[model samples]
Target: MWTKYSTLRATLKLHENADISQYGRLIAFLKNGSKNHKPKKAKVLEREHIQQFLVEAPNTKFSMMKVALLFGV
Candidate 1:
């Protein structure tokens, strides 16, 4: 069974040959948040999920700046 993450990596590799650097950044962001925030799963994340992350992130005991940087907000 293909896990969501494996599917995502395969999809990116198969169809997204351009903008490799941007994809690299996205992959890295999914794997590890900027310096403080916990990592989030990009494979199944939706818009609502992102919003939730943004909302709950600040409350965590991490640098606010780090969360902002992670989201580019």
Candidate 2:
């Protein structure tokens, strides 16, 4: 049986090599869209998909601005 602590420990170990800010950004993105909706599963993002996202994303939003800065596009 998987306990909450065990799950968290496993997840931390799994992502220990990953950038911590990326994790924070992902969690924030999930929380932002999770209101009155089910969260979607994670998948690898493709360049085309990201480009589409950037194009459709509102320019006035801070998150999109950060994304633009991060991707330099």
Candidate 3:
């Protein structure tokens, strides 16, 4: 098992004043999970399970930053 961190900076995108969603969200796309951001979980058996877990992780900490998540495999 490994650990990772979410990118509060990249998701914030301070460089651009992009328009947020009607509910206030970013439209930027990412090819992979953020290198710094990842979700917490117990041991897993498959990679697919990792993907699913990360997707459902609630942003309990940075609930306001709209941070992007990433993981280490």
RMSD of each: 16.0, 14.5, 17.9
Worst 10 residues of 2 by lDDT: 1-10
Local accuracy of candidate 1 as per-residue lDDT tens digits, 1-73: 1256567666777898433435566667655744565557678767787667766676656567556757788
Error of 2 at 28 (Å): 36
Give the per-residue lDDT of model 2 (tens digit) for 1-73: 1244356656776888533334766567656765667558999879887777677777777575757657887
| All candidates: TM-score | 0.25, 0.32, 0.23
* Backbone clashes counted, model 3: 6
Candidate 1 whole-model C-alpha lDDT, 0 to 1: 0.62
| lDDT string, candidate 3, 1-73, tens digits | 1121124444545556532332222223232334556668897558776566566656785434334434231
CA shift of 11, model 1, Å: 28
The window of 10 residues in a row where model 3 has the poorest summed lDDT is: 22-31
* TM-score winner between candidates 1 and 2: 2
Q: Which candidate should be chosen as best, given TM-score against the real structure?
A: 2
